[model samples]
Target: MAIGYQSLFNDNDSVDKANTHKIYDVIIVGSGVSGSFMAKELVDAGLDVLLLEAGEFFSRTNFPKKEIDANSKLYWSGGIEFNKSADLAFLRPKVVGGGSIVNQALLDRFDDMALDSFKEQSGVSFFTKESMQPWYEKAESEIHQEVIPKEHRNKNAEIFAKGFEENNYLYDSLTRAQKNCAYEEGNDCIECLSGCRRDSKQSTLITTLKSAINNGLHMKSLFEVKNIVHKTDEVRVDGIHLKREYESFRAKKLVLASGAMGNSKLLLNSGFKKSLPALGQNFYSHPQFMVLGLFKEQINSGNGPFQALKSADPNFRRKGFKLENVFAPPVGISMLLPGHGEEHQQLMKKISHMACIEVAIRDTNPGSIKTNRHGKMIIDKKLNEEDKKRKNAGIEAINNIFSSQGAQRIIEGNLPIGLHLMGGLGIGERARFSVVTPDFHLHGYKNIFAADSSIFPNAPGINPSLTIMALTKMAASKVFR
Candidate 1:
């Protein structure tokens, strides 16, 4: 009977209206970092929690060691997809761990200046540092957060660090959530994209999910929630319509954490609110580009951790948020190379000594995420004008860093890709401007909640995982009560 909620996705006839109608406390959509954190919080608060994930549960070992396989299989849009233009490729994860499994594990505290801007425009007072600082601190503690020690860094990082010194820019080793450390200096590169094998990268799969399961939380993976069913008013959440192969399951109280684009399309298809509009807007891609460095010496680039060093200019928000950091998995750099044949082979020769740094631009351009009639998600976005201006600036920043680090024959290229796509079902003031409220509750739908990047009113222009954890922790505290 404990598996009843999970069995909903396994059998179509199990939870039919005539067979049985059992209502539970919470049905949280998504098993990503935020949802996992919420599941733990709610279960610890003494509530029966059902976590619905659109993807399969993947263990760390389940990931492939090769970067290409990791990208094609674990990534959201199959490692590459176009965002408004074919020249750009957007990378999103399809696994339950979300981007945590593949991301460079760059943890950053959002600038108060950016949060203040959101508060000023959206009238959402929760965007202040003083209000959210304790929550961030608490989340960080729960995640066992710490900056990567210098000893764990590779030669490429030291080189990049020198660039910061030369330019008078502040550089700090980025924070990562790994357990016991077992990283080597330069060949640990193959592990970054495939998910950490050393129990080192403490992605959400090992962190909060472990806590939730220990607390008796039920996780339903490979089950996609199709529609929300409402049984009159008074709002007990009633139940959900979900799919597992050919069958469907139902639940009471639905939580939509299906990323920004996924949630917006689902809400519209469910007919939650048709004329209300603005269901999927205010979206940001955090468009990313890479600059590769091939040094004169055989400085191994593939070893150690991913992105041990990072530098960001807080003032970049006006131009655009520019984060510069070295990347791992020597082969991962090949995808970003712009030329073919001889030119590509030349870069490949020194690949062993190669390192890369990426810049994820936070832009304000509005985009739309909708589902086609064929049940496929579709996203259309215009490159943010300001993002275009920052592209070169971002490349220049990374290039300068590499130069300072003694990199030679540096190559630069932008991929048609982005990560941490957000704000499809954005939370705002009135029904006219936004679909969801600041609390992540939809404007007209009660008990329906969103706990993912979809609720982001503005791109924080920083790596969003920890920020998502902090916000969802706050959301659980406010909504689940």
Candidate 2:
């Protein structure tokens, strides 16, 4: 089971015209984490489900290890998309598995504090810890998560953990959604971000989507959905296929799981802008920046699990940011390396000895996602004064951590980048102020639901994949109930 892009389904490559005329029980847009799980749930309930993905499907065997090739094939905007402010850049997935396809696979469950903020902002009681615990368990089971063992810690993780232990900062082994890769047998996790060449990471591609496909799910890859309209009985979705031809789909129920930006852009282009006033509002990216530690000893950060260590202190989390061990491939690491010309080359030479960590800021300030006249997405986000102070605080914390580790020098990332994109079609009290109702139903539209991070009321600073999966599972259950 290599982490290639092989289509395991019978009709994964093209649209199945056999059922194009028949109204599907449910049409789920975006075959990523939420859509994949929702499709599984619906199909398991005996509902006919059709899953649409905007990206081309590649086989696992074709998963590229090169950063350039991977970014071109797996990421949106060729991995260089940014917000209107230009201060924040985003790396988002455009593949079938979405962020799960290229993320570090960290699988932390949302803490009570994070959920408390959501409940407070949205007045949604089900956000309570007790209420969502079962959903988390179910998602954990589906993804096959486990804490990275001590022996599997690479030199990069060792240096990161040493920094925490020496500074008396509580740190713990990270639990990730991954399968055993037998690292001792020469298998490495460096390629996980590029699609896990060993097939060890439990992305939706190998977990939920694969299971759904096996259970008779209909997936139409390379089908970019443009607009969706709610009519008298069923919903209509129009889009272009891979062949540059128009395609239309109809369903009794529709789910928008095409991420925060994707979902908002679609709704805006479909002429539902006024009806869903909050469609592209309330966007947050959990502003993140990296700190690299230059060690005298070879850390070989690129050879081991990309993110195997994380801060365990509740106080640190309360301060609006968390530190997690991180590593990047050659090309990515080179770009993050400071200096230019020969100076940059000198740092690139030390790539093997560099250990990195990212400080993910929990942004409370809201942003908006808009579409230009041509229908291209235009994300506008800014760090408020409070967010600025927090950014400085998080950076100082990272410096302290590296100082404790006896690093020769520290390099702060020149660019502030975020991978977690949330909000936009938030679930809350007001229809004019929020895009979806508390139950994830899009306002003014019957049987249309948003089952992704787009509906998140606020930013959850931690890795959001696990939380998204749990929330979608709960939403799917409610849909059928």
Candidate 3:
């Protein structure tokens, strides 16, 4: 199916709202972390910026404090977790702030190992911990990064750490992006599954998007960009053709930050995929597995950011870089409790004290995406032998960590949620092999650029948001000039 189907969702009823007067210098697709930062940076540099978001406007009030939005107004089928298969569930958030709004807000920096590993793969040489260190500090500072002391840690977490150290494993205080912190005793992260409140999460909603809006960056939520209209070899990205919005509009330059899935669909639909064959190839979804520990004491694992601590042993290596990690949430506590009767009831009562740790692995798995016969973007991801092996190793390491930490009993969680989606448009030397260059510009299209995770040379076995930010900033710095 043609990726241009986004046109079907456009809203053109308000022809009167069309801006016949001014032309924006740049049009940014998706208002997530990168898009918001990109728009703000462009506008701050005196460029007319327009940012578009496919989801609705998520304000402080409209958003729910519920554990999951499954029953909230923003609850959409696609927004909630869904697996291509009925027995599985894939986690992805659809809203104004993008994944940043729904994520655990683990604002970690680019470790040296991750940067180096990515460089050797597609010859993407510019990404470096030193180069991105400044951005990291800035990002972390903005997010209010803090290291949770042993004092604030909940009883369960503190005990878990001790068990690890007693077993000769070094586990330090886990840092997190939060305002009111307390995980020492395994204090539960109250709103993690939903989204952090108290504005302490430091998500893009409070940082990039907030700043962009404050700087006159025009934002249009619920606007999905469907096509890129080219006239006279000049690129004209029409605002997505929606069922209820603007019919068509123009922009000088287009920046796509709609994320791996969304950007891949838009590019393939716009016919850019024809020129660059690797448009949606080399897809990497960091296979993640969680190990939950059910304790007899009241842990209250449900309280804080879904994840506040992480394990960093068996460093992930590709070329010469070491992978970094934080903590996982207490998700499996429900199932791991002792029994089906009174035992289960008592465990549920003490669920607050339960905690979990995850081993998230960035694999070499290569997956492909295809537009379904119906024209909707369908992701067909398959894990090969290599991916399976890597996943197993990651699982082993995670299980070991949990055991060392004195987890009473452990069981692998349900389908591993693939959070880090990447590689539809990678940065390689060849156009046929790579859709975009290390610079994130389309191989043949000079005016069109993709600044999302689609440009990842390969998966770096860690959170992609920070890397996404660095790459987007790098692209905007060179392309916008």
Candidate 4:
């Protein structure tokens, strides 16, 4: 009998001494969007590749079904990490598929405004639409995408559209990376946020990762990298296996695909900041806030497709914010709403009559990432004055929409969430300001590379999953060519 897909993962017992001693062509530090696609490209070129992840690998059948279980199992810091200030919460995924596993599956390309800002900031000529079109096309070809039909729009989606129309704001349907959602069977998309049980979502674990494995790529899970030793010709990675045993591996070249926090923490912990002074600077997160509207009739926002529309207003885009129709599980909603005891219970009782809209801001200020003496990652991020102005503008627009729709009460979420994490190891022409070069290699090191959201010079004010895939595809082509 043939082994299942989960058997491809190498645990402590499955990893032999000979495999650890052998030097490979390339070793990637993450198995998320960037690393998985990069592995597929390089493996197709007949190169030996090893991909490592710090989380456990789960098959479709074994994925967490409940909201609390999924949040605790699939994310870092139990699905919510706080900065020193504790005003903002960061949801960073620590699984094999990374953010793609838990995100809303929104797929969007960067517009001219976003690309122009990036090109101007990083001095990269290829940021233009014409230059990046081929790469984006290649990335899109690897996955299936679809737009939610008008007939399937839920009450929440209808409310969003009506509010936008009544307020004269432009909106559009969202394009998602999915296969067969099976809406005819009355399946709820909110339930698939943790990990799609039906394998409908086109996450890297089901797309590029499967192809890479078939092309002879080696993958190890639950192996956390603790240190990196860069040699003249090879790179050695040392880490703990299952939190106790020591394991090390060597490769001719290494690529860091861990997100902004993971990459910054790893580099700072390994003492690379001495050589690369800007290692952890320029960190950014697209801060998002939830605004809820309570209605007299039952909206049942969580019943069907949870999200279907996004703000397409050029004015809103230029104003540094976008609105989205979204809903969460009961556990998440409870956390978002304020009050206690009977007050909280009353809100929970009206869950079926609530609709939500999220304001995602394009933050102007950048923060820094550092490590204390204990080697724990410290994230120093805050919304500057300009960011606050933009957020307030978005909130005002949402309030107008709710009032126009005759909302009984409008509630703004107290906590600000950081979902689109970017920067830290930004890429640029000058080494003084950036950690990575335009060609996606470290400034001082030639054998190490990175091309994930960590290298993004700034926020794009749009969904970044598709752009990440495109950038990594371009990186693979340029690095190998």
Candidate 5:
């Protein structure tokens, strides 16, 4: 009950949304990568900013040490949400930092192909690689990014590299938003994937949010925003405290960076369905599943950098998928392996001798997110025939790599889990399905904007945190300019 508040410095009530009297110049919904960056930029530019988060605020000092506790406290539905068909699970963060807090910290720029696709879909020239390059650099400069050196790779990563090299498959070290760590000596980077007890991961919670708070940004966590009434002059945000009591705030400008699902749900709940018919349409989540190889020797896959190597092959990109060396903790990985009872326990016992690879599909078949009358979010995502083919191809490639390394057996994850959630209030030319214009403005509303992955026209087959930040920078510049 007392979990979702930020007691920064001596002002314990500073994060209380009701404590403020004057209308803020800008109210940022969600404190993830996009909102955090936007909040920092606006506050530094002498604008009064208020950030409202539905989840609790947590620091590295008080973050959950165990993965189970982390899942329950920091993630939505304990990080085990599923689709309508119950075949896929989606991992969404419910904490202040959002996805940045729970993600693997892979920081990659959008390639030319992805940029060109965005331009073609949204008809926005600024979406091109040439124009967005400086914004990407600006986003990267705000966070610490380093390539995982060969010396820092664990045996699991080494095995992946060995197979890729022997098989002549294109692969390279991944660039992650991480500080120097002792992962090579087996420091266990699994904690970073959960809640990051080490503080080595460069999430916006510790970087942009900290800087914004220092520059007079008021952030209230545990406040679920349910409605946003677009008025002639100001936007009224109606939210309820964790206690289920009603509270409201007014802002001259409202920025919706509450993620793809969150933004869609809010707009639908706010009675804007008629004006914004595309509120929950064009949703995408890069569907991902893992393939594990059973090796004779103990690889201790859980003891080091979880994702150190990634396939750089152009063929896979052409096929609309990508592969990366990835692993998870006991609870996370166990869900991927099939079977139960003695059979499942036996595989769990051999987890230390397993090497893992993840296949993330850039799904062409877009999905939809709808909310029932009772306000429950319904996610509908299914793999089309093309997606199935690409997934099969990725699995075969993983099998080839593991077999080249002399794997005794290969295990494929049957159920897909989506870590990257994008689109909902997509930007495009003004029409029936365009929630936002090319300027990132809500179609019918003047002072409302979207800066998160919710506005992505399509999914880019890479980690989207950096791109989200870059998009935030571009959106914020439009505001200040």
Candidate 6:
């Protein structure tokens, strides 16, 4: 059976071509964290599922090694999409495994503060720690997780820990979704950020999606859904294949697991805005800014684990920001590092001596996603005064950390990167404020559902990938049962 981009054009009888004619039990759009997990559950229950992805699929053997290649191939808008004002750049993944394939794999569950705020904003009863513990446990059991051993901590992590201690702040080791990272064998976690070639990151591609495929889940990559038509009994999905050929598929049920912007744009383009009034509002991205600390001695942050510690300070949490010890590839760092001409060249020369921390703000102001007259996505997101204050506080904390470690200079990144894209299709009891229901169904559609970050009601002020998986598990059990 042909399954990738090239398979869409095959003249001979292919599984994809044959499957298009028969209505599936469920057709899931976007093979990301939510889609992959949901497909696994449904397929395990013996359902005929078809998972369609707009991006290409890649195995460990074919994963891109170079930073530039991975950015262009694994991400949407070539690794940097901007809002209307262009102040914030969004790094949205467009691969089969979505953000899971490219992220650092930090797997922290939401705390009481996060869950409380979610319940307040969303009015969903299941956002509590008690109600969600079982689902979180279920999601955790599906993947391998480990805390980064202290012996594996690199100079960057040491600097972060020392700074936190000096400033009387709390910090903790990060739990990552991985198995055998082989750090003792001289393996660097920095290289896996683009897409894990060693299969240690435990992305959906290597976990849920692989299991789903074994359980009779069918996947077709490079098949973008341009429009969706809902009939009384079935939903019809139509789109372009590899941006060239037209194709359509029918299913009894439809699931949209695309990210915030993708889901909003698709629904708007398909003319569902009339019925779904709150289709593209309340969007949040945990906007992050990197601050680089230059030291006289070499840090060699890229040589070992790229990230190992995260802010666990209650004061910082109350201040609505979190700090993380992080380092990026040269290509990504160059974009964040400020300057031009000889100044930029000198900074690049000192890359080995620089350590970095990022400030991730829990933005209070919500952005909105919309489609223009030409059907192009227009993202309007900005940092309000409260969000700006939170960012400044985080940056000040980072500067203090850098100074305590005898840093010569501190430079903040010129741009904010929106890594955790959420909301837009928020889940709430009322239709006026949300798109998806607490049960994970679309407002007026019986068989259409969404279970992803797009259904987030507000920013959780923490890593959201693990919660996305847990919520999908809850959704699958509630909706499919």
Name the regions of candidate 5 deviating beyond 4 angstroms: 1-13, 17-20, 184-186
After aligning candidate 5 to the native by TM-score, how far in Å is the CA of 461 from where it should be? Answer: 1.4
TM-score, one value per model = 0.88, 0.96, 0.83, 0.96, 0.96, 0.97
Q: 162 in model 3: Cα distance from truth in Å? A: 2.6
lDDT of 3: 0.61
CA-RMSD of model 5: 1.9
The alpha-carbon deviation from the true structure for residue 94 of candidate 1, after best TM-score superposition, in angstroms, is 1.8
Candidate 4 lDDT at 276 equals 90
Number of backbone clashes in candidate 4? 0
Candidate 2 per-residue C-alpha lDDT over 1-481 given as tens digits, one digit per residue, 9 for 90 to 100: 1223344554443234325687988899998788888888887888888998887565466777678899888887777798887878898788878787788888888888889988888877888889989999888888777788888788878877887887778999898888887778877776877787666888887888877877778778778999898986799899988759888889998999999989999999998887777789999988888889999998887775667888888777878888888877777777687789999999999888888988889987999999989998998899998888778877887788888888899999888887888998988877877788877788877689987989988898888888889989988976766
lDDT of 6 by residue, 274-392 (tens): 99999999999999999999999999888777899999999999999999999988988888878899999999999999999999999999999999999999999989999999999
Q: After superposition, how far is residue 152 of candidate 4 from its true place, in Å?
A: 0.5
In model 1, the Cα lDDT at residue 318 comes to 60
**Residue-level error in angstroms, candidate 4, position 350:** 1.2
lDDT of 4 by residue, 1-481 (tens): 1122535443323322226878989988988889889989988988888888887676577778889989888898787998779998898888777888888889999999999999999988889999889999999999999998888899999999999999999999999998889888998888778888788888887888878877678878777888999998999999886789889999999999998888999999999999899888888889999999999999998876788999999999989999999998989999999999999999999999999999999988898899998899888989999999999999999998888888999999978999888999998998988898988989989889999989998888889888889999988865566
CA lDDT, every model vs. true structure = 0.68, 0.82, 0.61, 0.87, 0.84, 0.89
Q: Per-residue lDDT for 67-182 in model 3, tens only?
A: 43422434235433433453223455556677777666655566676677677767766767777776665555545666765445555555556555554544545566666544
Ten-residue stretch with the least lDDT total in model 6:
6-15
Model 4's alpha-carbon lDDT is 0.87
Clashes of 1: 15
Worst-scoring 10-residue span by lDDT in model 2: 1-10
After TM-score superposition, the amount by which residue 312's alpha carbon in candidate 5 deviates from its true location, in angstroms, is 0.4
